[model samples]
Target: MVLEGVYKVRSIDEVVELLEKYRENAKIIAGGTDIVIALRNEKITPKVLIDISSIDELKSIKDEGEFIKIGAGVTFTKIVESSLFQKNLWGLYKACRLVGSPQIRNKGTIGGNIANGSSAADSIPPLICLGSTITLASKNGKRKVLLEEYYKDKANYGMKEDELLVSIDFKKPTENRVLSFAKLGLRKALAISRISIATFLELDKKGQVTTIRVASGSLGKYPMRELEVEEFLCGKKLNERTIDEAIKVVQQSMDERLKGRSTLPYKRVAVESMLRESIGDGIKFLDGVRA
Candidate 1:
């Protein structure tokens, strides 16, 4: 039942204090895009609505030494519009650009994307590929977890009800990093992805590919890094045979849960093409064929 509970709080400290006081009864709201729907569907019924949307500290993105720290309130629209972010993090920018329509992008945030942890989320795969970290905060203190390790137990990971996801920190890519993000959805816009992929490749001064990370979303119970595929590509040259070998490695690593999904047939074929195209784009970037 949608009973009228008095919505409360206007600041981060107030929200934190209320959460510390109410714990499981208090819920944080950023854009409330997903949460509102969950509430409408009777999936959750928090006694207190602590609006952190007004909190200034949680709405900025900045450089913090080796990482780019994106506050919880930073919207997808801002990500797509930022010149610095686009220049340095092409995969992330591309992912951001594909998120929802203009209205949704303006209201949806990176932190909200992470907190929701939905398998079909556009931003999570790239974040996982970039080796991001999430900062979860509460009145008690804060904890940081590697984005790749954040998901667990076939779709269940423990997060305290009182904790607020404060920020996501993506370690800046190494100089000359080649990254790509791709999604195949039912429609061009405002469509949940049937399959999505994110790839990152870093090469040494000698032109040998040193580090590779690939992650796939909407293909598992949780968005996951393709560690086995990445390991296989470590010393391999950027060539057709190597990319095909990497795709084979990806297919082998896919969990049975993914294989059982409805999109299996399309995804099986599409994912290989996505991987090939992404690796080709990476090679082009490395070879100075495109920026």
Candidate 2:
């Protein structure tokens, strides 16, 4: 690849200043996992590469009392290693842990995964399920957008050509709430996700679903919240009958969303087991609490 200049920025201001100067002609590079390949293939040609890997402002994971904040430049390996994500937030941990191979995880940042804009990005569904929000910084100013809206309405909510994503944050769920995730891949080792599900749920004392957010990857034009399935699941208790019926609800939604797509048939069948793992685990955890 031909580059007029490469800059390793030390602060957020430096990154945005370069982005402001180069605008569409500049590209941000962190892990360089995906962008490097794109660069090599000439799929994207930018006159400048702004490296943010060394920016301390973009490499932290903090528990900010009411919510958790993660810098955009924090890598999957860092998320996997962070103790904050080991409990109720384990879904985020599992998704990051399962992204590609060890080498990729060590270098791939959560912000880059979303920026890559692949429908199959493993980190996204879980983050979406967590009701995450991302911040964008530019010479103009900084703005925070709901992560889901940013993905679905990119033309409107997406970062401008001169903006940089700074960090992502989400409120902390109740201590007993469960955020579970499961994915279907060619192999468990290093396969990219063919399909993935993440469920953030809380059950009432009598085991009825009180709150739930379900999201899936590779199920649409982008990774998004499965609102139809979530609507079907709420107020209903988790069980074989309810779960079976909920799976059918998912199929119905996909039928309309992916009508003529070739991958629909395979997703229709594989989702049963995938849903069982993502949602059923919450049931098991709640059951154990009652026992």
Top candidate, metric lDDT: 2
Give the clash count for each candidate. 0, 0
lDDT computed for candidate 1 = 0.79
* True-structure RMSD, every candidate: 2.4, 1.2
Q: What TM-score would candidate 1 get against the native?
A: 0.91
lDDT of 1 by residue, 48-166 (tens): 67777777888888987787899988999988888756643787888889887899999988888888889988899989888888887778888888878888542344467767888
Residues 1-291, candidate 2: write the lDDT tens digits: 368989988999998889988988999999999999999999999999999999998999999999999999999999999999877888899899899999999999998998887999999999999889999999889999999999899989977889899999999987768888999998988888999999999898888999999999988999999999899989988889999999999888888989999999999999889999999876776676567
Off by over 4 Å in 2: none
Runs of candidate 1 with Cα error greater than 4 angstroms are 1-3, 6-8, 153-157, 205-207, 289-291
Top candidate on TM-score is 2
